[model samples]
Target: MSASNRPAGSGRLLTGVAWATLLLGLWLWGRGITDGSGASSAPTTGDIAAVGRPHGVLLPAAHAPIKGTAPERIEIPSIGVRAPVVARGLDKAGGIDPPPFAKSQTVGWYGSGTRPGAAGAALLVGHVDTETKPAVFYGLSAARPGAKVRVVRTDGSVAEFTIDDVQVFTRKRFDARKAYGPRKDGRAELRLITCGGTFDRASHEYNANVVVSAYLTGEKPSAGKSA
Candidate 1:
């Protein structure tokens, strides 16, 4: 989702580093990030227009209750971030839903895709700014290519990903197909998202959205044995 599509709120927006850590932490908290269920009451004309477009396969239909557990800790040596995380789902309105962050608490997952290590683009989105204050993901614009991101899952598994690129696009120009399209090799990926660009008081949202693309390197085995 684009920044303009996000819900209005306020606070210090989290930087890219913080957002990554927050997602990892949410995984540790037992909040399943891949539980994609609950269909909207009715599809709008716009939704109908999007049908048959190659934006990627729709997630499965199954909404499991969120367990109130913190995600495992995450450490990104490249960005110098090590913190806890949480998970959350999108609100009734369609947007890049975010979780609450305070007292060292990170936001939760958007819960709209397969698990992080699954064979698809596991989406994790957060807020960039609210009405009164900057929200988490404010610093998302600072990320650069070749950066490293590390996530620890609740199953005592560690996944490492490398930042391939960062792109910023206007709300109108945003392409879900290219942004969330299926990978050629059928590998797992991470798409970290947040709002960006000039904030509009009238709209109470940023003009653009910042997206960071990362490809999974490999998973660490539970046992000492290397995979």
Candidate 2:
């Protein structure tokens, strides 16, 4: 049965990284990063355009080239989030693992994919809530377009991206390719993901996944790397 059609509490618990496993349909069957499709490809993934709302925040407009650096931290000043970033690999189930629930204040960067600030879509995933309370990305849905997301890298470079889109996709209709794929061939982009929408106590799952899309707008190299 489709996820949307399922009863509120009819969620399944899968093995492996519990948080990431909750999204088995996401990182596994839904990933189409190279499909070149967007939110319009299918009914399940919902409509990306519908979720993106304009905002009044001002952001840098200068675009930067990809640096391929390993991100160490992420700061979304608009939402008052300043969290350490840890490298995460997929579990045996192919689901990208998130930081342990105990580390609710941290986020995870997909070490297998394009590094943040690179010329492709970089993915960052986090938990919205744990079994008992709020987590790192708990307020991610409150972010607005034109807001800035800053990523500090191991190389000492800080990549700044401008938020332009945000949407929540239901697991059943999730189109991984369209949601994670690049919209432009060479533009550096970002996708911040976490569980969103209503929580299903019976299903032990979230009704949808929040996806925040951004693009590299500027970069500042560490003091030593600065010319």
Each model's lDDT comes to: 0.49, 0.70
Which segments of model 2 are wrong by more than 4 Å? 1-51, 55-62
How much is 126 displaced in model 2, in angstroms? Answer: 0.6
How many backbone collisions does model 2 have?
8
Write model 1 residue lDDT over 1-227, tens digit each, in one string. 23343344324343333333333333432343333222112211111111111244332222122211223654556544565556656445333346553422243455655456666666666555554554445455555555667667776667666666566544444445445544444666777766554555454444445666776765565565455
- Candidate 1, residue 76: Cα displacement in angstroms equals 3.5
What is the overall TM-score of model 2 with all chains considered together?
0.79
Per-residue CA lDDT of candidate 2, range 183-225, in tens? 6778899999876655565565555677889999988879897
| True lDDT of residue 151, candidate 1 | 69
What's the CA error at residue 192 for candidate 1, in Å?
0.4
Q: Mind sharing the TM-score for model 1?
A: 0.60
